[model samples]
Target chain A: MSQSTVPARGAARTSGTVRIVGAGLLGASIGHALTALGVDVVLSDTSPAQLRLAVDYGAGRPARGDDEPRLVVVAVPPDVVAQVIEQELADHPDAVVTDVASVKLEPLHALRARGVDLTHYIGSHPLAGRERGGAISARADIFIGRPWVVCRDAETSSADLAVVEGLALDLGATPLEMDPEEHDHSVALVSHVPQLVASLLAGRFVTAPEGSLRLAGPGVRDTTRIAASAPELWVQILGSNAEPVVEILDVLATDLAAVADALRHPDAPGARRTVADSIRRGNEGVERLPGKHGQNRRFAQIVVMVDDTPGQLGRLFGELGDLDVNVEDLRLEHSPGAQFGLAEISVVPSVVHGAVDGLTARGWKIASMPND
Target chain B: MSQSTVPARGAARTSGTVRIVGAGLLGASIGHALTALGVDVVLSDTSPAQLRLAVDYGAGRPARGDDEPRLVVVAVPPDVVAQVIEQELADHPDAVVTDVASVKLEPLHALRARGVDLTHYIGSHPLAGRERGGAISARADIFIGRPWVVCRDAETSSADLAVVEGLALDLGATPLEMDPEEHDHSVALVSHVPQLVASLLAGRFVTAPEGSLRLAGPGVRDTTRIAASAPELWVQILGSNAEPVVEILDVLATDLAAVADALRHPDAPGARRTVADSIRRGNEGVERLPGKHGQNRRFAQIVVMVDDTPGQLGRLFGELGDLDVNVEDLRLEHSPGAQFGLAEISVVPSVVHGAVDGLTARGWKIASMPND
Candidate 1:
């Protein structure tokens, strides 16, 4: 089992030679970052064209077989990830190996099924992405300020784990250690299940009358927002982590049926309770999230009406800056043909009075809306 | 049967005495808007306290029994909406009666079953509200540019239907006409089903490990944002439109079960296809909705790295305004424990190159990310 303290962040967080397998978005981005930090990076990919593109983009030099890398990172599609990890482990036997695949348990389970050596292998995932892919779209700072999860197994050495964490720290990502099972389950609950749910909800609108779609408000907008993600990428992710995802989906489906049944006979005994409980449970569930709802309770929200004109919002924000009020969060709300938008600015309660006074003095109209 | 085009836009969209039967959020808001337009508003409510509050807020004057209203609007809880509408029509036999209940079919059906007179009654719903309720949170501009749907029956006269449409136009809402059945089914697809789906997805997180919850990202955030709605209020809504909502939920549950089954056996024949179809259908469905992933196709997104400082976002937006590029939509993204956030601002494609050049020239870091 691995046991290591988190790396102490300093002027330099990563060191020695690092090898990155795959020259796609994640892999080349890692190469570009490490090379910028003065680390020797050897990049590899099955596609000569992609590898050459990465090298041309200064991500890293093409991988040379003779090179002895201290660490190896596999960043390939989820379907072929385990095979790639096995190849990297055998090719660079002395190097600490990690793969930046979204799913952790599947690859480890796949490798273990074949009894492949895993002493040097670790699994990690960074929760960062863009609308595009490939080396041409790669950027060094894409992983900055995102969660880089590192999963270590019983066979992973503490030194190897630290190397992985060090890489995360160097990229300005927050590193958190989790076992493979924990990592998979966590993502299933937060990422994979939510994706399917959004898809299911959005799919309902496909056959809806066009007029109904026009009545869509913030509620449906927020719920189905993620349904537009690419199916190919999601299929791989959902397939790799099918067991956990299916477990969540099965329960979710059952719950939906229960609510439907309750609605079908709302006057029956306990029918109303059943429907209420589903929504109440949802309230409790969402509250467990890190940034729970009722955020307005902690941060005072000053609802300011902004005109649809170009500089109006800019001027409002600029004035808030002048008042030295750091807006913790903000939400923009508008109707289909409304000329004005409402900007709900969340600031610390202590500064709210001053913010309101300052905004009013600046001739801003603040709308008062209280919770029932 | 009523046959009429929508009311024409005019300087004075409403005239004569208007009576609102309930002083709740929607009712008081209508009263406030009409009162401001120099129209006589007669407001009534079962709760004297609420009626007084609305009156004190200048929403409307107290309803006098002797006064004949030109139009009567019923705004109350969904469970009692039909009962109130029946009473309103009987009390003001000469006035055109409309109710702002969310579900139109249930109330209309309830009224028909009771053998109530229907000639002067038209059902309507304004798709406008706030997190809060009652006159305390009411505003004159709440309905501005929002959809106001009017449902007319075969017994409705053209003059009465126009009265209802005029009410919508007076409140600055665009009125659309549909039969009660169409309105109910549309809301079920766009609003009710989505609400339940969000609640169902969020309910799964009730027992999730804290660590997993920390990995929550935009997908989960967007999907579960509405799960915090009041359970009591939702129970009534779900019950009132149970037939339509249940129909949608049944199909959604069936779809969910199929995807779950596919994930359980991803390698089996046609399993991956099932999963892929679910997501593909989602893509098609969300495309039917007004926004997207389609938003991405329309607007070029410029992601700028912003320091978590007071003036960083303000400066970015101000600079965008200076470039004369109006940001169509925006998203602020950051990870826990990160010192900087990424502001993804969507701008019209025509202005993207110029906006990006301006931002880059102003020393803003724009990260390039491509679709995978």
Candidate 2:
């Protein structure tokens, strides 16, 4: 079914009301975005305050009657996402429903084994979020341009897919259709595994001596930034996506073992080869990544200095644009001495030389480019 | 000795010169930075064109007399870095010298075993570079505000340390003192291991079916950007830093195994715990990283969109400054659609809400914050 076949405004009549079961970040945000588009949204939450906050935030109005909505989006904590989805399916049999959860396969399988109505329900995960949570944080364009993966099973009706896809488009997001297994596996590699690696690295420093962490720099930050996410939330995500995530981590472990053995004895030529092989592999991995706008496939570096002032760095970027150098990537390092900061700018190799020269000529001191 | 006691400009000493043998990217860049600071620098390279290019680039002039410079920096491909450092040291006695190779312990041991003058020699590596190579790519500020690590040993003299530190300082870099072993180990964890992981992930796609890579996004790019580096250069670096790198990879591998197992059997409770543990650990690791400018550590997510217009982004940032939000970190995702891009803005969480509201109120469409 095309989007035009659905109601143009205030929710689709055929689907009844669109009831948002939880008033948290995802649910409330969805309500807000949909409401802004003039959809009839009714929000229900266990917490009266949260529900009111959702309404206040313009996500939706409180449910006034027992009338079942055509669609119910269950957006709760991951551990509870499956339960909420299951409960909603039971509570409102006629409503075509879905979820916005990180992990999908297990939830789908659980519902399948329990023989929940598969035609009216689909699984979805909008690959977006922040460190903060709640309805107050909701925005209308939250999913804009992000990938919203829809997990479709054999029993999923064409109408179900259309509803989810329409929702994605409504929020300015792209819909990516995939099987539950593929979705789980892909996220395991990209999201779950990476999150674990970051957390493991970050955890190492929790027990470190004082000065040791003082030396931690941008690399560590880049590697572990995701680790700073809410622990309870992650537990839910990892718990649901355990299998695929573990598989990738296992592969990493095997590689890690080889590397460790080599490090213990570098005199052996084979050890050197092992180490070189790994680094080479990493180099290759980095290259496969798409460049800015998915144009070039090479990674660029951005380096700049941070000053003590509150907004000095922000202004520096403003200046960079005046120079017309498109920065592909950036990393920052603050020097030990007072009053100095360093920002690394990674751009296309084609523009690196010019950007360096331009920035230097503009009177902004360039920090780490090689000197000939 | 305090920096104040060191002569602001060492008397234009006629003392023996520092012979930089390779005149390639690392060699020439070092020479250029040094020459700009009035250090007596002599440039040499196997390629005459490269030698001339070094001169044109202002790295240094050819050595005029037979007198060996007080220091010799052998900046060559990793495969030849050790050989070149040995050759240069053999050619220059009574001169304090160092090699700016990425890996350290091996070369230091190699020199020791070969009976090179240890008293005047140290193993040093400046944690800096670009994907491009050669003299033309060099910049005088290559090491400025970057870490120039001096790997010391019993043979390394205080004077040698001072000289290397001076070079780093003059180049506007931070001089870090470390034992050769410690330096190798630290870099293995921070640099070499990351390189390998990136490569391995990228290599998975080197043989990917056609068009599969076109769908690659920022996650892949961020993970694989370092893969585009010169392969031969990395071979040498990994070869030298093999032992420690391998060791770290082993630890990582163990973590990977646990993750893999969890993925393979999601229903198993232990698997869930393992995944959660990994993520938690990553969170801890991320927190250990030092904040920019030695300030309170906080993370900022920057969101922005790129329009097809050449400088539309430039204008957006130019306007950002007027709103008074300090952008601590920024990431832009390129989508295929016309007239739209995805920009994620990370600022101090304390101010991110205000910034988002400010941007939205200004009619700039903002992506939903993660929590939202």
Candidate 3:
């Protein structure tokens, strides 16, 4: 129900219909964005109920028999992506087809081995999603400001490439180009490998004593949060993106063994140094993370204490608003047993002193000084 | 600067001075809590400036030559905990002494090997802390609702055990009893090993290409957050609790290898099943975690879309207050480039429909359905 005020930028679409072959979250959301941009769109799916839900959500209407689509977007699970793309290309000979599967190279290889015409097909993946599925969770603004990588090869025509890039732009996303294999390896490093690691670490707690878990703090809670992600979906994602993920996990297992051995014989020569160096590398690794607006600049955080009651956070933010201190980011830390919560507000360095002074004057308790 | 309205819930202690041997975060915070409960607290540290800072913050006064302390708390680094406890026991022959080091067995063994009298000494660890250290980050309520594990042997006198438990209670902590070895193994499982795993995982990111790092999401971010913890401090913790942590890490390394091998050869016997079983085990592990108030009950979350401007979050929370929705927990998500943020408010299931309908009627955009 929210709207973006940023105007669309790109060459005019010159009137064409885009047909989407799936009615899941991504497909419906794509249709919603294209429809908003004045492009005639059609949605098709195997399940009539799912197709109707997407249509009712204003993604698109049922496909018309007489329609001639210029672009066919295949939005489906990774395992079926290659088969769906092959079929769509056959169904609409002139349309440039693209499949939004997470694993690009595997599907490309599948289609290539089947001897399909590769000139009109491109592989693309939008790095925006939710833990839940279905059209009910779909939103037109899900991809805004997110990266949508398009996989292009030598055979992809310039005109076809522009159409895909234009669609990404119209959906308020920044489209970047990468080869299929490169995209797979990048996501494996960032996404798939992390998922497996989180799962494996969380599995350790399954048989733990209740009393031991009573001592579980924020550190353990955070390090295992992603383990709650839907396993069925991840099974498919990991299965298709297997090779690169396996490679990363193998390397991580080796490092894990090294740390274990060092801890086992801490008195051995250079053992403590090995432990220290491993942790230091972690320090350097986290520092490479980009800050606000993709800049390397870090913001300072000011913590204020608030009671765990209605309107407490609202009143705190209101006081901050009166002081004209723009909060760049905010994190709330509280447990159900605690009677109060701490609101950590991030702001640029220049305004921190003023913000702290103003909040303290307003009777807000300062918990800690500005920290990175 | 804030005060807890919840009255202290322990037997009235009409007592003499309690001496604290360190003036850092934990030492000063314990002094602060005991002082609030009408206990005479004497503080001492090697650094005069640090001692004065703790005193200025009302944690305690400087120790006096004629003073007689009934209890002495040794709150120092893990590596020096044994030496500090020995010195404290020697100084206060008639007093009961406890060391608040993270690892328990190492210090106990060191004192036993040194032939120190064991009747008046207890090893304890309060599972409460902040990422930052020093008197500046000290809080009186840090121990509230947290587990304080007291390690007592057969030689520990009833009077000394009661005094230690009383100290834990006076600080608003739930005191649980365990042997030194059991306490060490428990913490190694819950705290120390997770720290190593997080650091090792984050260490991999140090040399990652910029493009691969760009794809990092909340999953990777949460799994590696504790990697930013102070490395020198953790090196000592892991070294002190080496046996259990190393044992767990070794087992985890084996499991990681199995998952990797399975992913590498999905067609091999039971390979796909192994991957799914590993993920399923993670789900079971997470389900074992207690929910709010240390109960197994789960709460439903109400997500409301908030605009990126000042006062938007305040307005939404203010509306929730008017509707009498008690927010159990809250999380905020937004990217710097996005025009809006989402506030995920957790509430009890019985009130979820009411909260959703009330917020929706008041013009709030619902992003997702209620989730645990």
Per-residue lDDT for B266 in model 2? 69
Model 1 alpha-carbon miss at residue B132, Å? 4.4
Give the CAPRI class of candidate 3. acceptable
Q: Write the per-residue lDDT of candidate 1 for residues A90-193, one digit (tens) a residue.
A: 88888998999989988888999999988998899997665457888788767876688998877777898899988987776778898888989999999989
* TM values, all candidates: 0.89, 0.82, 0.87
Root-mean-square deviation (CA) per prediction: 4.7, 5.2, 4.2
Higher-lDDT candidate of 2 and 3: 3
What TM-score would you give candidate 1 relative to the actual structure? 0.89
Backbone clash pairs for candidate 3 read none
Per-residue lDDT of model 3, residues A218-317, tens digit only: 7787777777767777788898999999888888888888878888888789989988988888877766654232331366778777887766776776
User: Candidate 2 residues A165-259, lDDT tens each?
Assistant: 88887776677887777777767666666666666655656655444454444554455556666777877777777766665666666666666
Total clashes, candidate 2? 96
True contacts kept of each: 0.69, 0.47, 0.54
